[model samples]
Target: MRPIWVWLKGPLPAVPWPHSESRPDVDLTPEHVVVVGASLAGLRAVEAARRLGFPGRLTLVGDEEHLPYDRPPLSKEYLGDLPGVAPMLATAEDLRELDVELLLGAPAEALDLTARSLLIGGESVAYDRLLIATGATPRRLPGSEGLSGVCTLRGLSDAIRIRAAFDAGARVVVIGAGFIGSELASSARARGLDVTIVEALTTPLVRAVGAGAGAALSALHERNGTELLCGVGVEGLEQQRGAVTGVRLADGRLLPADLVIVGIGVVPATGWLAGSGLELENGIVVDETLRATADVWAAGDVARWMSPDFETLLRLEHWTNAAEMGAHAMKNLLDPEAAEPYRHIPYFWSDWYGHRIQFAGVPTGEPEVVTGSWTSDEFAALYHDGDRVVGALTLDRRGDIMKYRAMIGRRTSRREALAFAASRRQPIVAAAG
Candidate 1:
């Protein structure tokens, strides 16, 4: 059937359709829509499809038994003593209202694109359309398996165990000084636990927001009484009677710890899609429209798609990107012919020792502090590539971060960004070389 494409009203920037000839013969009105991975992206896809008046038999599949819950809080708020309640993405009644067949604890085993079926827990489910949002799995430390007191914060269960350890006054050693690792250290310090962070790079988050900003932000750890060890590699985990006791550094240093949190990073959860005829690189390779194959669409951390704005392929593991990409992928799935290219300006925020660190766009170089100095707690900096303002970083400047985000989206020049920052009446610092 000829698909009926409905163009939603919005002020989205138009870009050239790069996959006009590769557009799939999709059934806009499918009989069944199956979404794999019931996390944020998958849940949002299900919700968006139902909200858009899709009257198909909808199924949401998840490996975890629990319903979709907020993951960002797992490393921060949920790990604290006052974890109010589980940050559930949807309630039972909400799912019932949407007529969703929720399949929990049954992970998708494999995909049969030829038969248009999914194998899950020894059962085959047929579908006319599919959305893969399996997300990513936390990378584990080699030779540390089967050891107690070693944990990675990816879900609720992990958070609960870590919180229990914190309550018991465990000495914490966090590996990798990324967002999750940094937040874990912050929470550990807040609980009055002895905490130390070990990062392999010369400066934590140097790859994300450039060396200058990363070094500046890493200072928050030292300011909060947490030991920050950079440029050190972990040899292995020291174990005592099948429980982790400390981290053994490659430089013959043993950092004692009762609990170890590994926040290194995550790998795309595309193992099940291996040999499934799907293009897989570091993740499930999708086009600008988030399409994998003829009728299969991928989103969230599992899908790496082309970014029309940057004219490159991006695979973001942030919550904002997952949530936004989920909804966008659903819209494109519903209206294939008029599918809009996802041109998201990546944004992420991290809380460390009562400081809110927010960054927007892609960091191309060392940030130029346009307003406020690096010594001060409250400041806004702009990152530029030549003349174009490619990114912005702020510490506790919550009110002004969005302005820079918009500036990055509009491809605003560095001069204009600096002028905008100067208009705030704050003393402007000289631009970085």
Candidate 2:
């Protein structure tokens, strides 16, 4: 069967799609840009707009009270309770210098795409260009809501609470073996806490890195003293007087726990645009230019746009994609005449138990070829769909990954990738350069 992405492929929208074309009354000035979701993507949108010479009313709205901060650290150093590991990306002075009107702690209640206005805090804010960077929220397990001692780490506050649990030496039961759950387990194990990770899949990160690499990661955690319960589904949460105490598994085993963290994944924050006439699927569907509707654009995890390079629509949740997509969305918003389709090679990295795992490109299909040993702490795996190098993953081999990143970017043939991978030549730097 063809891949889902192939099935979803369609013709790219013609240049100057509706609401993307220039209008006489439309204010193309900087101050007219309204960015929702005060996240890494949202903050970058405002900054990129300014850099693109958008000089007008620039307003940023966010549901969280805290200013934009780094989220990836929340699972690593922040979870370990390391001092001075602030995730703040921009300071108050920085926003002021950028002339960004930041409206923190105000959630967007409704969106008027036709009127090009956003309703927040009982006020309608008009905008010539609206960028939705609301990102995503952590998926919660059923019956876990309203229960104390249960947390989903998505924000700074969530990380703090989980850190406190770790500080208390709480027995942690993570409900997914994905990136977040695995990283949290690593942190909990580092603090000498009894950690257990339950994954419905056969291995960790099978979706991102494939079963082979995922199994290697699963073993990595097991070597670090984390209990691995793979291929088991959680039936429900066991609670004691409104507080979580344990997790009930599908096979009738009850895993006792002091704290439970659900890392099942996340859904895009597109609920506010429900009746606003924007097409919604896993995310807000946009054209090749990332325009959701007339005068409205979206970026980050919340916006799913057609990938001209990959030949399918993609909504990436990684930090790198969010920042790049935000800048691209804003640039197109400022200049629709010169608007270019969003084409990017997706990339992301995660730190787990003293190992840095980085991946570039899509990593689609099976693990067709590998450059080095997977059991080793340092190696790189090159994934291919037939003769085309689609993606690559590296374990502590940053330099090697960059080479494969370029190969995938150039759409190198499988023969070339294999030759590069199998070559016993020294100094890959010269060959790659």
Candidate 3:
């Protein structure tokens, strides 16, 4: 509840709130660009639009009061001992610099996309270029401990509550062993707090990283002393006086904890765009250019564009890809410069325990693994698609991974690409080296 200082790109004194637009607000005009969902991608999109000489009125609407801050820190720096320097993506004053009209604490209830306006609370704001950056919300479980301490780590408020609980020396029980869940467990363990991660899946991060990477991540968590419980479902939550005390697993087990962090996954916040005529699958279905059919564009966690390598239209939740896609959307909005199809190979890095883990590209289907080592612990295994590097797992290898990502773009044969494993140097952190 306290407005802690978030360092951001510069030294930002902490002020609070939280962006996106998928539905094009055609009624908007310098005149106006109403950006829904004041989130990472939303703020970035706002900045990019203004930077690219968007001579228009800008209004940023969101459901939360917290300003544009980085979500990744909720698991790493913010949750850990690192303080007074947490990097918030954008600050309130930053909005002033961009001349962006701020509408905070107002939940956008409905989207009149046809009328090019948003019915927020009671007011209707008409816009021209609407960017639906409504990011995903935490998937809440029914009858599960809806307690004061039972929380999720997605937005700023969620992180603040969890941090306060951790600071108070609460033993945290994290349900679901996905990315956010695993990262939360790592941070809690790093703080020397008792932490247990419960997952119904056989392997943690099975959906996100697949089995191979999940195994490595599990090992990392084990090394950090985080309890990883898999293939167990949560039947219900133990509550007393409306406060969660613990969770009951489907296996007839009760794990005791004062604080519970549920990071099951996120559902795309495309509910406002419902019946808006813009295709909304898992996310807003955008073409290669990050455009969702009409003049409306989509990016970040909410905007699911086509995956060129997969040869299928897919929504990506990776931070790197989201940022890149936002940039691409901005470029296209200004004046698209790409000749061929606009494709960005997905990449993500998680700082857990003592390792800054990074994964590049999608590893959905059967991928032939090239090279890796668990003990010495420094390697990069390229995932080959018929002799072409479709995906790669990088352990401590930073620089070469960039080149490997470029190789995926060349459409090279998988066999020829993986042949250089022995000759190449191992994975290195981009910052360290």
Clashing pairs for model 1 are none
Global lDDT of each candidate: 0.85, 0.82, 0.72
Task: Report the candidate with higher lDDT, 2 versus 3.
Answer: 2
Candidate 1 per-residue C-alpha lDDT over 189-301 given as tens digits, one digit per residue, 9 for 90 to 100: 98899999999999888888878788888988888999999998999888889999889999999999899999899999999988999999999999999998889999999
Candidate 2, pairs of clashing residues: 30-54, 30-55, 30-56, 31-56, 31-57, 31-58, 32-57
For candidate 3, give the lDDT of residue 15: 26
Task: Indicate the residue-level lDDT of 137 in model 2.
Answer: 90
Candidate 3 runs further than 4 Å off: 1-30, 84-86, 334-341, 366-369, 374-376, 425-433
The order by descending lDDT is 1, 2, 3
lDDT of 2: 0.82
- Minimal lDDT window, size 10, model 3: 12-21
Candidate number achieving the greatest TM-score relative to the actual structure = 1
> TM per model?
0.91, 0.90, 0.86
In model 2, the Cα lDDT at residue 278 comes to 90
